[model samples]
Every structure is written in structure tokens, then in C-alpha cells.
Target: MRIAIAGAGLAGLSTAWLLDPLHHTVLFEPQERLGGHSHTVTAEVDGHETPIDLGAQHISPTAFPALANLLDAVGLTQDLIPVPLSTTLQVHDAATGRPEVLLAGPHTADPGWPRTPVLGAAAGSLTALVTRAAEWETRDVSWERSLDELIEPLEVPRDHKDRLLYPLLASFVGCDIAEAREMSARAAMAFVLRVPPASPDTAPLWHNLKNGLGSLTTALAADLHHGEIHPGRGVDHVRRGRDGLDIIDTRGHHHHVDRLVLAIPPGEAARLLEPLAGTSAVCAALGTFDYVDVTVTAHTDPTYLPADRRHWSTNTITVHNGWSETTTWYGPINGAQAFKSWTTHRPQPPREPLADATFRQLRLTPAAIRARDVVGQAQGDGGVHFAGHYLQDIDSQESALLSAIATTQRIAPDSPRLTDMLTRAPHASDPPEKG
Candidate 1:
């Protein structure tokens, strides 16, 4: 049996890794590299060089089972480092230069440095405030609703509303909370709050690879054998064949395979299979999914923002007041003192220069995001299959890998080769709703 897979993103590669050997697998990658959204690019920050992730960064240890397995399989578990979550969020406050820390989750000792003078907020009062924040979160409030309710009454001195709330919301939803869908808001808040409670004494754990995410991709590809990959080939079209699937590449080459895996974005897959014979509602529903653009900035300077150790007057903050195109934040990486920040959730369609510049000031902005439209249509059935996080409720490197592995299991159930590959346990104890 021969299997054909399109796109070499994490999901596509995962599928190939799982199905190969059992079947003669061929992978199509339009790009020269394999990381896809799991990207880390280098940029100069204040004359120093640093590596920053352009796509997915900071994976919570609790949320990614497949990622953990992949890391262990590649013997890169030692490269995983936990990034602490304590920091001071500063906002530009009028009259009062003092910034305040918008602390949530569990109360940590030494709330780092006070962004503004410690409002004399007592321990019990602080706990109650955090509990209230959690309550609003658990109820699945849209960021719009939560921000309106949480920001309006707080008479805290400083630009806390814009500096703290806005950026946090933007990073979560990849769009401004005001414009974000209620469902997206609920999901983001729920995910963030679910992080293991962190105390000043006990550091919160957020893990990432020390050598960069590329290390994981390179390792997986190597284990899978480099011969399976076909670089510089874009999937032009796909159709049902007598045995299974007929894949047409950009170069007009056709290959017959027992199974075809459309691991591209939903939109791209939908377009390719539209000309094919059968289609499913899943594909049509994919057309309705919307996406926002994210711009990434890499810097080596610990000046504007210090390393993970010291708290800045204003380090990571969210802005939602008035009308802003996107939400943004700044953070430090592990093993190095470099700092980087990005603004996400700005529309990606082409826009004017002023708008682009304002957004890019945060290293990422609406203009950079809007320039490229994300494909949302993914449709297929029977002989054909589709994979990627865009069609599902969550999109991330972890999700992509999970989808690929799961899809391959369904396509080739009796493959003995996949037995040695670790089977990942579901992260949530509760079963996920089936689509």
C-alpha cells in the first residue's frame, strides 16, 4: 500500500511517521523546511541576537500529551525547561506613573515587583479578587463581556486596562477581545486558567525546547527517514481513484496510492477536493471558520524588558480599551536573556501603511497578519482524508500532531510498525465532544 500526504507541517509529518513502513509513504512539502507553524526565527534585539518563535510558543506541560511523547521519543526530554509565570504588568497611567500587577490564578509570594505601589491589597482581598476572576472565567464569558465587567469598575491608578487586559486577551484569542467571538473568548480564558496554580514559592511550569522547536521537527523527520519527504512539491489537486486516491502535484505529476491524507489547511484542502466526486459537511463547515494574523518580533535586548528573572514596570499587558486593531505582549525566553513580543488577532488582508506601522511597533500587528489570508475550507470522504488543527476547536503544534497520529490509526488500523510508537493519553480526564 502506498500513502500520499500533502503539506509537511507537524500534522502531515506526524501522519507520515505513523503510516510509513506499514505503507510506502510519500510526503509533499512546499517549503524547504519542516517546522510549519512550529517556527523559531532569529532577530537582533538592541544589537544582540536572539531566537524567537514566529508561530507557536510556550506549551503548557499539562495540555500536550503528544508533544511530551514526541520529546521523550527523540531523547530531547532534557531540553525541556519550565518558564515561570510571575511578572509585573505596567500600563501608562495618567498622573500616576505607578503601574499595577493584574495577578490571577494562585497568589504567589513576593508578587515580584509592584508595577504600581502595592495598593495595600490584603491577602484575603487578593484571594477574593483572584477567585472572582476565576469565576468569570469558568462561566465562559466572552472576552468582551469579561473586560467590560472587570475593567469598568476597577479604580486602580495606572494604564492597567490597556496595558494589562488588552494584550492578554489578544494573545489568547489571536484577535482583540472586543472583536473576538464569544466561543473563542471562552476557550482561551478556560485554557489559561486551567494552568497549574503557581505560587511565588512554587514556580509555574511552561515548557519549550532549548535548542528551538526546529529540533523536534528535525528529529521526527530523521527518525521517519528523510527519503519519505518530497520537497518543493505543492499538491495541485486530489481525486478518488479505483483503488484509493490520485494525487496531482503542482508539476502535473500524478501518483496513485491506497490512501490520501490532505494535511494542508482546511481552505486549501477544500479547494483541492471540491473538484473531486464526494464531499462531506465537515468540509463545508470548515469554510465558515475564521482566522486572524499574528506578527512575531525577536529581540536580544534585556533593556525594554528584562530576562525571566527581573520584573519590569510593565512587561506583559493586554489592551482592549477604545478601538485597537490587535492585542500584544512581551516576554523572555528560556536559557537566554533575550526578550521578544508579538501582537496577534489583527485581520490579514492588505491595509494602509500607518495601520501596519502602529501594529508592527509591537513586532507584530494587523498589517503583517492581514497580508496572508488563512484557508478555511476542508472537505473529503472515504478514500480521502484531511488533517490539521484549523478545522478543529483548537489549533496548535500539539493538536496537529495528535490529529495526524489519530488519522493514521484510523486509516491503517493493523499496521504493526506503529505499535512501538507511543500512544498518547488524552490530556482532559473528561471526554472531548466528537465532531
Candidate 2:
């Protein structure tokens, strides 16, 4: 079978890698490199170079079993460590040169709880919401409801929900407050449930892939002997022909393939299939899904974090211009120290930007979840296939790998490697809902 996949992200690369043994596959990636979100930039830190990932940085092997197994199968096992869950919310008083600690999460830098009435109330409400969410999540029927609807029953104060909780949820989706409010109730539950039990006492064994995702993508691309990767070539559009599908590249070159797999986002897929007849069903389903821009910048800027050094944590969320943006303490290099910021959420951009890239993430709204089901139902229709994390059962790297395996099985069910990976290999045990 001849397959052409658009977008060279994890999903696309995994698909091609799985089918390389028996099938001919071609990948169309616009960038000069192979990995999409699995990008890495090597920087000299304290006279030693360390690879800093700007996108799709970490994955917990325990939670993402399928991804772990796949990496093992490819002979790429290196580093694993517990996920750091330290998070803080605070703002700096520029004139005073101090930070007013607003609120904190588990492993937050300062364990002392807030005292302000509103902050105290919000802390209490967070506990209530977590308790309330845990109760309803097991019902299974709760997922059908919107987050706003679920919150309505809680009677959470407008101030508490807006000023505190919503931004936290928005950060999870890499979106703004308005987008977060529309997320599914399950989306919020997923975040709270994934919270690790009281720190060092009873911690969950979720490990981060410390070697960086670039190595993973590189290994996958290197293993593809039967596939050709076009680095600078991007699929402009696809049109259904009498024989097969015609893929028009950005360079005005057309390539015909027996099957076309759209590993890109649903929004991009919908736009690509817009010209085709009898695709409205899929396009309409795709339309229900939306994406928000998340720009990540690698910098050594300390101004992005709170002014006070005590406020620095693994993840420091600064609310500036009524938007919640995160600046991560990436490294401890002397001059090569890296503190990456998600600049899209902030109106004030980080200074001395080292490297910047923008990515689009699927906003998990109730409508999008419903649309996920619809898209799942329409897979393998009209010689076109869908492959991505969003189309999988869970939105994670494990899901992305499973999606690739499942899509390949549909495309080449007889492929022995695909069959082995599905039947004999370890798959992702359901991930604990973590924000």
C-alpha cells in the first residue's frame, strides 16, 4: 500500500514508522527537520551542552505505557524521573520589588496558605471543586455536561471562579480564560484527579522522559527504511481523483497515493478536505474542534518570573494583563540558564528570546469531545484516514502512538509488526487525569 501522511508530528512519524516494513509511505513536512512538536535545541550550559526542549517536552512512562513500550521496542531507553508538580500563582509589585503570593498548589514553593479573604475563599473553593469533581467523575454521565454547567451547581463565587480557578484551567489547555470556561467538565476533573498524593509520603510513579523527545522522533524517522521523508515539502491540499487521491505539495508538485492520512489537527484537516464532496460530515465534525495558539520562548529572562526569588518554583504562573502565563525554570546553567515562557498567553513578551515556536492545541470543550467521537466514527472512510492524539481515547503521547498503531492496522492490517505491537506489546494503562 502507498500511504501519504500530512504533518510530521509524533502521530504522522509513528504511522510511517509502523508501516515501513511492508508498505511504501511518504511524509510531507514543511520544516527542514522531521519532528513536529518533538523539537529540541541544544545550548551550552555551564560549559556543558544540554538539550532544551521547547515543545512536547515530557511524558510519564508509567501513565503513558504504550509510549514507553514503543520507545523500548525502538531501543531508546535512557532517563526517567518523577514529574515535578510544583506550581505557584503570584504577581510582582514592581515598585515594592516583592511578590504578593496569591495561591499555591501541591509542592508549591511556600506551604504557608494565603490569608487574604478572597484568596482564602478561593483555596477553600478549590478543595470543594476537587471534592465535587471526584464525586461526579465516576458517574460516567458527568462527562456529557459542560464545565460551566457543573460549576453552576457548586455556586462558586464569580470572583473565585474568574480571578483564580479559570486561569489555572486555561493554563492546562494553553488557552485563555474564555476558552477554558467552555471546556468539558471532565477536562477540569482530569486535572484535579491527576494531582499526586501528599508529596514524598505517597507519590504516584509517573516519570518524565528526561532524554528529550527529539531522540524519540529521530529514532522513529531513522527506522523508516521503506518511507521517504520530504523535509521542505508540505501538502498544500488533497483532491479525490477517479484512481486515487492527488496530493498537491507547497512547491506545486502533485503526488498520487492509494491512501491519504491526515495526521494534522482537526481544524487543518477540515480545511484540507473542504473541496471534496461527501466530506461535509467529517468537516462539520472537525469544525466543532478548535485550537488556540501557544507560543513558547526559550530565554534567560528572570523578569518573566516573580521578582522575589522565594516565589520561583518549577512552574511559576504570572497573571499579567488579566492573562495567566507560565514561565518554567528549565535549567540551572550559569550563563546558559534557560527559563522558557509561553508568550502567547501574555501581552508583554519575554525579553532576549533565544528560540520561539508557536503550536496549536485542541481546546477540550464538550463540543470538541463530542466531535472526537464523530471523527472516530468516520475513520477510514473514502480511502482517507485520520491519525492524531485528539482522535485517540486520551489526548497524550500514548494516545498518539495508539492512534498510529490503530490507523496502520486499518491501512495494513496484515502488517506483522503492527499486529505484534497491538497484540503482544504493552499498551497505555488509562492515564490518571493530570492538569
Candidate 3:
């Protein structure tokens, strides 16, 4: 089968990776770089080149083993580093214009978390939320429930809900705090339920790529032996012919293929399919995706962290107004104050910052579940298939890889390579969100 994949992100690359040795494939990406969210920027710090990832940096091996299996296949599993993503928070007072130090991160071994009244309530409430999520894992009530619905009954401080929980969930969904509160309970808590939050009482549940997550994407591109990957050029649109499909590139060039996989975001995919024939269902599914604009900046700015150094955790969140900004510090990695900061509303990139990038991140909701159902029905419709994180039960690099596997399984069930991959990978059929 001749397959044409659009977008050279994780899903597109992984799809081509699986089908290439068994079939001919071509991938088209609009950008010059290959990875989409798995971007890593290299910076010169004291004559040493350090890799900084601005997006999709954390993973859970036990919760999402398919991606780990993919890493093993690419020979990059050795680069995986177990890192704790503990968080510390600071909230601004609107009337007094003062910042209050909230719960110090558990990573600090701060024994005072249980002593503070607000922190104590928050801790017990958070444990309740996690327990509720676990129940949802065994129950069916999460689909109709929103995170706000769950948080309202906890009766914790408004600070915990607005500043900490909202920001964390927003970053995960790539939405604003408002949308984060409104997102489905399942989307918000599935992550917390499967991947344990950073805590002094428990083991670390997440892993970071030592060389940066870009290593995963770069390895996928480099390992592709039977496919043509076109970067700097992309498929602008597609048309259906009597025999197959016509893939029109941004440069007005045309190529023919038997099948097409859209690995781009929802908005991009919907635009490309506008000119295609018999795609009403696919278009409906893609249209259900909602995205928000966000800027990610990487730098050595100490100001991004909390005022007191002892309270610093892997993540430092500052709450101003009704919104929150997050600083992801990698100081423990190389013993420096290197950080990545992102927010829906916050400071612009610093002048001459190490790296700055903007993105339209997916905001998952109950509608996404419906969208996925629609796309699932139209998987092989008119030789058009969809694969990406947004289409999964939860949004993450692991989900993106799972999307590729699910799409490829539909594309070619008898390929020897696919058979071998599934056989070698444990829980290969289980979705990542299910843990």
C-alpha cells in the first residue's frame, strides 16, 4: 500500500515508522523541523550546549508503556531519566499587591505542608480527588462530570482550585483556566489517577528524556528507512480521484497515494480536508477540537522561580489576577537554574532568551470523546485516516504514539513488523489513559 502521511510530528513519524518496511510511505510537514510538540532547543551555556524542551517533556513508563516500547525500538530508551515534577505555588493578593507563599513542594521534604491549615485541607482534598478518579476508573460517571464539579464539593481554598489545579490542568490540555475548569473530569483526573503526583511519601511516577524529548522525534526520522519525509513543505489540501487521491503540496506540486493520514492538529487537518471528497464525518470530528494560544520560553532566568530558593520545586507556579503562570526548572538535571515558562497570560519572552515558541494546544473535553468516536468510525473512510494526541483518550506524547499504533493497526494488520511490534510490547492494546 502506498500511504501518504501529513505532519511529521510524533504520530505521523511513528505511523510511517511502522508501515514503511512493509509499505511505501511519504510524509509532508510544513515546518523545516520534524518534531511538532517534541521540540528541543539547544543553548550555549558557558560553552556547553544544553538541550531544552519547550513542550511534552514528561512521560510515565508504567502508565504508558507503548511509547517506552517505541523508545526501545528506536534504541533511545537509555536516554530516559526518572524525574520528579513537584510543584510550589505563589499567589498574588489583588488588594494588597503582595504575594503569599503557598504550599512548599513535597520535593523539598518540607514537613510543614500538613501544619498549615490551607495546605492540610488541600492535601486531603487532593487525595479525595485522586480517589474519585480511581473510582471513575472503575465506574462510568466521569464522562458527564467536569473538574469544577468535582472540585466544588472539596471545599478547599479558592487558591488551590484557581491557582494550582487550574494551571496544572490547563497546561495538560493547552487551554485557559476557564476551559480547564470546564473540561471533562475524566480528561483532568485520568492523568493524576495513573501518574502519581510528585510527593515525598511516594516514588517518582514520571520520566524525562535526558537529551530532551526531541531525541524521540529525531530518532524516529533517522530510523525511517522506507519512507520519504518532506520537511519545509506540506500538503496544503487533497482531492479525490477516480482511482486514488491527489495530495497537493504547499508549492503547488501534486503526488498520488492510496491512503492519507493526517498527523497535524485538528484545525490544520480540517482545513486540508475541505477540498477533499466525502469527508463530512471526518470534518465533523476534526472540528470538535478546540485550541488555545500559548507561548513557551526557555531561559536561565532566576526570577521565574519563587523568591525563596528553598521552596523551589521542579515546577514553580505564580498566580496573578485570576490566571497562573508556570516555570519548569531543570536545575536538578545539570545543577543550574535553567527553566521553561509557559502561560495563557503572562510575561512575553525575555530579550535574547534561549528559545521562544508559540503553539495552539489542544483543549480536550467531553466533545473530544464524541469526536474520537466519529473519527473511529471513519478511520478508513475514502482512504483518509487520523492520528495524533488530540484524538486519544488523553493528550500526551504516549497518546500520540498510541494513535499511530491504532491507525497503523487499521492500515495494515498483516505486516510482519507491526506483528512483531505488538507482540514485543506489553499491554500493547491498552490505551495509555487507562494505565
Candidate 4:
């Protein structure tokens, strides 16, 4: 099969990687460079070029082994650097205007004092809900309920929910309180449960490529032997024909392929697939997914963090009512206070001024939760498979890779690579126990 993949992000690249050697493949990317959201930006600091990921940053080897396997396949396992296990989380208290610190180590947070009792209760409730939901063969009930709906029924106090529980859940997915609440119960629960509880004995909770995530994409692209990558060539339109599929690029060039894999965002896919045969329902479903613009500013300013250096130990600082910005610790890139501030939901300036460069991304809203089934239905349709972060409610490197694996499995079941990838991939059903 001559497979044509649109969008050269991790999903497109991974799909091409799995399908190549078995089938002739070609990848088209609209941007001049590949690695769409897995981008890494470099800065000259102290006479050294430092790599800071302005896009997808962290990876969990224990939870999402597909990414680890991919790194191994590309000979980049040596570049895997473990993130610091000893960290703190600063939850900004709206009323006091000061941040409350939650000490995190390895697999769990040291829930102290007022937060202890509430945190215990919330964790217990979430575990029960997630466990029960996981056991159910049909998640229709969980899927229909929003995170807010699921948490409202819990017996925790309103204050605790506002301060600790809600913020914790929101921080897990990198969304604000409102956005988290709007998320589907299943989507939120799946993300929350995937995070293994902090364990003192565990080596490290997360890892990142020493060079950057871009290296992974670069390696994947380099390893492709049977595919032609056309960066800066955008697909203008897509329509199915009796012969196969007709793809017209923005350059007025036409390409014919036996199969078409859309590894781009849903909105882009919808625009292209709308004119195709028997795809109106799918296009409509894709159109329903709304997106929020997020701006990530990379800076070295200590003012971006709390006044006390002790609070700076925290990897993530989530503001209770602030939807515009979420702070992330970049672990001292180039001897500077490296951090990325994420502004979500609405257009606004960074909560504080930034001294470094900023990168913007369009992320799916909680509304995408409702369209998950539709995306699956479209992917199941033969010949055309959709792979991207939008397929899953949360957008991350892990989800993007998983989406590609799923698309490859659906479109190329006979490929030995697909079987191997699936065999090595972690089972979503068997989540690790939280401490």
C-alpha cells in the first residue's frame, strides 16, 4: 500500500515509522520544520547552547512505555535524563495571595496538616472512582459525566475541593479549574490515575531527552527508509475516488495513494475530509471539538516564581483562579531559572512579564471529550485513519504516540512492527496504584 500521511508531528512520524519497510509511505507537513508540538528551542547561555522544550516536555517511561520503546528503537535511549524526584508544588491561594507548598518526592506528595486530611479523602475517592470505572467494560456512564459532576458527589468539603483536590486534578492535565471541571470524568480520571503515586524507592517519576524532544522526531525521520518527507507542503484538499484517494497540495500538485492517514488536528482533518465520500458525519464530529490557544513563555526571571526560594523547588505552580497562566520548572537550562509559563482558555498577557521567548499552541478544550467516540468511528473506517492528540481528550507526547500506535494497528494489523509496539506498550487498563 502507498500510504500518504498528513502532518509530520509525532503521530504522523510514528505512523510512517511503523508502516514503512512493509509499505511505501510519504509524509506531508505544512510547517517548514517537522516535530510540530514536540519542538525544542535553543538559547545561548554562559557560552553554551541550552535546549529548552517550548512544546511537549515530560515523558513517563513506566506509564507510557511506547515512547520509551520508540526512544530505544531510534537509539536515543542514552539521551533519556530522569527528572528530579524531589520537588514541590505551589498552589497559589487566591485569598492570601501567597503560595502554599506541597512537598513531592518520587511517587507521592507529603500531604501535611490541613491538606493531609482533605488530600487523603480526595485521593481515596478518586482511587475508588477510577477503580470502579476501570472495571466496567462499558464506560458510557463515566464518559457522560463531567469531572465536576463526578467530584460534586464526593463527600469532601467544598474548601478542600477548591484549594487542594480541584487544583491537583487541574494541574495533572495542565488545565485551569473551569476547564478541568468541564472535562469528562473518564478523561480526567484516566489522566489522574496514570500518574503513579510518589514512591521513595522509585528511581524517578519522569524523564526527558537530554538534548530535547525534537531529537526523538529527528531520529524517527532519519530512520525512515521507505518514506519521502515533504515539509512545507500543505495538503489543500482531500477527496476519495473510485481509484483510491486524491490529495491536492497547496502547490497545485496532485498525489494518489492507496490509503490516507490524517495525523493532523481534527479541525484540519475535518476541512479536508468534508468533501470526501461518506465522511460528512465524521467531519461534523471533528468540527465539534473546540480548541484553546496556549502561550508558553520561557524565561529565567525569578520574579515569575514565589518570593521564597524554598517554594521554587516545586516543579509546577498552579494558580487557583488564574486561567491565563500555569508555571512549570524547566530544571535550570543553561544556569538560568528556566521555566515555561502556560496561558490557557483566553487571550491575555502572561501573568507576569517574560524576559525570554514565547511559543504558542492550540490545545483541545474539554468539549473534545464528547467527540472521542466519533474519532474512533472515523479511524475504524477502512483506508483512512486519523491519528493525533485530538483523538484522545488530553494532548501530550504520550497521547500523540498512543494515537499513532492505535491508527497503525487499525490500518496495518499485519505489520510485525505494529504487533511488537502493542506488545511492549503499557496497558491503559492496568494503572499503577497511587500512594
Candidate 5:
């Protein structure tokens, strides 16, 4: 079978890698390079060129079995290095103009971050809610409530919810607290509960590649012997015929294939699928998703962090002000000489004076949340499969990989490698709700 995959992100690459070698596979990417948002760049630090990931970084070794297995298959397991699970969250008090250190621990020690009385009480209430909700989650009935609706019933003080709980949830989706409130309750629960436990003496739970995530893509690309990768080529239109699928590139080159996989964002997918029949429902579903642009800056300045060096853990810092909450998270690179800081904000005009190093990222908004059944309905008819982070309603490396695996299996159900990988992969398990 001749298969054509769109977008050279992790999903597209993984699809090509897992398909049977007998099939003719080709990947079409609009960018000149691969890896989509999993990009890595080099910065000169202390007379040495060190790689820093300007895009997606960090993965949970236990939660993301598909990615772990992929690294093993590609012989890049040696490149995986564990990062400290500890974090130092700075909760900014708007009235006082000072941020309080909620959690502070080095990568090696457990930081018993304390919560305020109100916040602690609120946490207990939320735990009870989740415990009850879990029973509903396993049943046939739907529990598709927004985060805001769930919080509304809780008796916690508004201050605590806005300051602590909301900011924490906002960080999960890379959106403001107000926006996160609109997110599905299930998604917020999944993200928050998946976070590894942190203690002063706990070992690292998250891992990153020694050279950056780009190395994983490079390795996957190299392993594709039977497929062709067309960089700098964008698919302008996709039309399904009686026999096969037809794809037209920006340069007007025509190609035909027996099957097609779209690994790009939903908006772009909606545009391409609009011209094809039996895709209206899927296209309209794609159009329902809302997106925001985020900017991450890498800099040598530690001044942007807290005054005390002891509180400089590579965790998230959340600034709370009612509904408009912003999170600032950092990752140390090149022995702490440089760091990457990410800011999640609503779309707006570009700021004048770019940071020393910056990368712009696109993410989903809360309105995009849908029940799993709704997602199933959006899976367009016959040979056209959709894969990417948005499919899962969350943006993360693990989400993207899992989406790819699911899409691949849907297309090539009989492929042994793909089937075996899925069978052995660990399912996403939620952590015990905190009281």
C-alpha cells in the first residue's frame, strides 16, 4: 500500500516508523526541518556550544511508556537523562507585590511545600470531588463538566481557588486561569493527577534527552529506510477518490496514495479536509478548537527568578491575580549558566525587543474540550486519520506520541510491531487525589 503522512512532527514520524516496510510511505512537512515544535538550538555557554530545547521538553518515564519504548527501539535510550522532580513555585500576591515561596527543594531533596489554611482546605474538598467523580468516570454516563462548574460547588474560599488551585490547573494547559476554568474537568484532573509526588529526598521522575528532543526525531528519521521525507513541502489540498487519495503540494506537485494520515493541527486539518466529501462533521469539529500563541524565552539572567538562590528549583512559578493568572516555569541548561523560561498568555501583538532566545508556540484553549465519544465522531471516514496533541485536548510530548500510536493502529491494524507496542505500553494511571 502507498501511504502518505502529513506534517513531520513526532506523530508523522512515528507513523512512518511503525508501518510495515512493504508499504511505500512518504512524509510531507511544510518546514525545512523536521520535529515540528520539538526544536532544539545551540547557545554558546562558557566557550562551548550547548543544546537547548526551545520547544517541547520533559517527559514522565513511567507515564509515557510509548515514548520510552520508542527511544529503546531507536537506540537512543542512553540519551535519556532524568531531571529533578522537585519544584519551587512562586505564588505572587497582587496586593503585596511580593511572591511567596510555596515549594522549594533542590533536584535531590523533597521540598515539603506548605499550603495556606484556605488552600489546604480547598485541596481536601477537591480530593473528595475527584474521589466521587472517579466512580462516574468508569460508568456509561458522561461526566463532561467544565473545571469552573466543578469548582463552583466546592465551598472553598474564592481567594484560595483563584490563587492556588486555579493557577496550578492553568499551568497544566499553558493558559490563563480564566481560560483553564473552561477546560473539561476530566482533562484538568488527568494533568494534575499525573504529576509525580515531590518530597525533599525524592529522586528525579521526569527525563529529557542529553542533546535535546530533536535527537529523538533525528533518530526516527534515520530509521525510516522505506519512506521518503519531503521537507519544505506543504500539502495544499487533499481529495479522496474512488480508488485512492490525491495530495497537491504548494509547488503544485501531484501525488497519489492508497492511504493518508494527517498529523498536523486541527485548524490546518479542517482546511485540507473541507474540500473532501464525508469530512464536514470532522472539519466542523476541528473548527471548534481555540488556540493561543505562547512565547518561551531562554536567557542567561537569573534576575528573572527569585532573590534567594536556594529557591531556584526548575519548577513552575505562578503569578495569581483573580482570573488573569500567568505561570513562569524554567529549565536550567549548560550548568545553570542559561535557562529557558516559558510564559503562557493570550494572543496579542508581538512584544518589541525579543528576549535573548525565544520560541513561539501554539496551544489549545478550553472551549476545545470534548467527550471521548465526540472525538470518535470526529475521526473522518476511510483511510484519513487525524493525529496530534489536539486530539487529546492537551499539548505535551506524551499526548502527541500516544495520539500517533492510536492513529497508526487504526490505519494498519494488522501490523505486528504497532500492535505489540500498544499491548506492552503502560496505560495512563492517575495519582491518588491529594487531601
Candidate 6:
């Protein structure tokens, strides 16, 4: 059977890798290169050329075993290094105009580390909320009900609740916390608590690619046969028939295949497959999932950051915009600070204004942050399948790998070699060709 898989990001490549050989497979990507949001930028540093990641700077050990396994399979595991999480927060006082280094630590006892003192303040309320959220039983009730039940009862400080918790929740849902359902937050809190701090010497518990994250995705793409990949092609439509599928690209080219898999974003899938029945709700839900705009400013010089100061900030930070606010994070990787933010409101034209020198200030404002959720599904029709990092539950390579494994299972049953080798995935019968 000939199969066409759209998008050459990790999910697309993984699906192609898993299904090929057993059946003919061709994967398309609109970008000239693979690895959608996981590409790297090269910079000259200290006389030699070095690369920096503007996307996904860190990986947690707790939630990334599947990602790690994929890296190991592609022979890129050695590129990983344990990064200590050194973070210092300088909270600004609006009225007093003073910056207080509220909390600093790679260690509980490090000099200037205000672990307990800061926690004793209103920050203590955060630990309580986080603790309670994580400890709660997870079941069906919609994420919306869970959040109101959890947060409303907490006696947290008003400013902290507004400035800190709400923003953090926004980042989690990629939408306003009020718009986000509570089930998602509950699931997120559980994931955060599972990973304990790594060590006293190392930064908080996170890992980075010694080279760059692109290594893992690129290596996966490289391992596939050249004939298997078709880059720079955006799939515009999918035609379902009794036999199988006809995937149409943006250029009006159609490729017939016995199986079709969509490895693109959920929103993209929703748009392309809207004609199919049952997909409308998934599409509607997908439209609700927001994505944050990320402007990764790479400071050319590491010296710009004070040496005495710790480079890590909160894994997430919330800042006030003119009326509302957004969330962001900072990480020093490959000798540069990466500032990632997502905004509450979508810009008028959905433009990357950061690419323009005149609109550079937008990158600093809280409103520049983008919505971050990517929803994908098999709800549209039985013939088409959806998968990606966003669809896999979280934004990590492991989730991408899992999505690939799951999508492959849905699209091609009896093709067990890939899953047996890379993932212990469950088997599913490919639906009978739509009649």
C-alpha cells in the first residue's frame, strides 16, 4: 500500500519510519528542512562555530523517557547533558521601583538562595496550591470544574493569584485560565510533581542536548531513506474514498494511497478535513486550543548576563501587559539566553512581527506571547489519522514519538516491526476502507 504522510516534523518522520518498508511511504513538509519547531540556529562563538536552540531548550527526566528512547534509537543520545537549574527571580515593585531577588537557587543552601524566606511570604500560597492540585484525584469532570474547585478554595494572595497562578495556568492551557478546562491543569500538576529535584549541585531537574535538540529530530529524518521524504510540500486537502485516500498538496498535486496519516497540527487537520463527518467537533475543539507566540532572542554574548547572577528564571513567568498579561520563560543554553513568551490575544494578521526590526518591541510585551495548544485527532473520519508533538499530550520529543507510534498503529495494523523495535505500542486494526 502506498501512504502519504503530511508534515516532516518529528511526528511525520516517525510515522513514515514506522510504516515504510512494510508499505511504500512518502512524507511531505512545507519547510525545506525537517523538525518543525525543533530546529537550531548556528552562531559563531569564541572563534568556532556553535549552534543554539531557539525552541524547546530543556527536557525533564520525568516526562521524557519516550523522547530519550527515540534519541537513543537514532544514535543521538550521547549529545545530551544534565543541566543544573539555576534560577533567580528579581520581582519588581511597581510602587517602590525596587527589584527584589525573591528566590535564587541551584541549591537549597546556595548563597542568596531564599528558599524558605520567599516561600514564607505570599509565595508560600503557591506551594500550597500546586501541592493540592497535584495531590487531587484525577477523573472525568471537565478541566473547568476541577480548576474552580481547586483555586477558589485556596486562600492565596490576590496579587500572586492574579500575577503568578493565573499566568502559569494560561501557559498550561495555551488559553486564558478561565477558558481552560480544569482537567488539563490537573494532569499538568501531576506531571510536574512526578519529577523531583535532581541534585544539590545540578540546576533543578532538566536536561539539554549537548549539541542541540535539532540533532535528535534531524538524526531521525536522516535515518529514513531519501525516497521516503518529500519536503516543501504543504498538504491542503485530503480526499477519502472507498479504496483509501487522495492527499492533495498546496500545489494541487494529488497522491493516491491506501492509507493516509496527518502528522501536522490539529488546527491544520481540522481545516483540511472539515468536509468529513464527526470531524467538526474535533475541529471546533481544536480551534479553541490556543498557541503562544514564541520569540527566542539569542543574546550573542553570554557576558551580557551578569556572572554573579543565576541564569535560570522560573521554568515559567507571568508579566502584565497594558490591560491583561501573558507568560514567558528564560533559559541559558549554548551560551545564550532564550526568552520564550506567549500572549493572550491573537494579533490582527497572525504575523511574526519579531522578524521585523521596527516591530521588535512587540517581542518584549506580554501581548506578544502566543497561544500554545496543538489539537489533533482521529475523530474526523476513520480513513485519516492525526499525530504530532502537540497531539501527543505535551510538547516534547517523547510525546512526538508516542504520537508516531499511536498514529502508525491506527493507520497500519499488522506492521509490528517498528513498534516492537522502538515502542511497545498496542495494536489496532486499520479501519475498513470507507465505502
Overall lDDT per candidate, in order of appearance: 0.53, 0.72, 0.76, 0.66, 0.66, 0.54
Q: Which TM-score value belongs to model 6?
A: 0.75
In candidate 4, position 389 carries an lDDT of 77
Candidate 2 ranges beyond 4 A from true positions: 91-99, 108-123, 155-158, 198-206, 331-336, 345-347, 424-435
- Supply the global lDDT for candidate 4: 0.66
By TM-score, the best candidate is 3
lDDT of 1: 0.53
lDDT of 3 by residue, 235-342 (tens): 987999767888999989999999999999987888888776677777877898777777888888767565667667777777776566778887655544578888
lDDT (Cα, tens digit) per residue for candidate 4, span 1-435: 888999999999999999878888989998898998888877654456778787777776776677777776667777776564333445566688666654332322333311121133534544555555565315456465666777676575675556555565565555666676776666656544565446533323566777889999899899888899999998899777676888888778889998999998888888988776788888888987755555667665454455555445325545545442456665432234466666453234454333433333433445566677877876756578899876764667878888888888777788777777767644333323223
Per-structure clash totals for the candidates: 22, 0, 0, 5, 5, 23
Candidate 1, residue 50: Cα displacement in angstroms equals 5.1
Model 2 gets an lDDT of 0.72
In model 3, state the lDDT of residue 404. 90
Please report, as a residue range, the 10-residue window in candidate 5 with the lowest summed lDDT: 426-435
Model 5 lDDT tens row, 84-103: 54545567666786777654
In candidate 3, stretches whose alpha carbon ends up further than 4 angstroms from where it belongs are 108-119, 157-159, 197-203, 347-352, 425-435
Give me the displacement of residue 377 in model 3, in angstroms.
0.9
Error of 4 at 398 (Å): 2.8
Arrange candidates by TM-score, descending.
3, 2, 5, 4, 6, 1
Candidate with better lDDT, 2 vs 5: 2
In model 4, the runs with Cα more than 4 Å from the true position are 85-141, 171-176, 198-204, 332-336, 343-370, 380-382, 392-394, 419-435
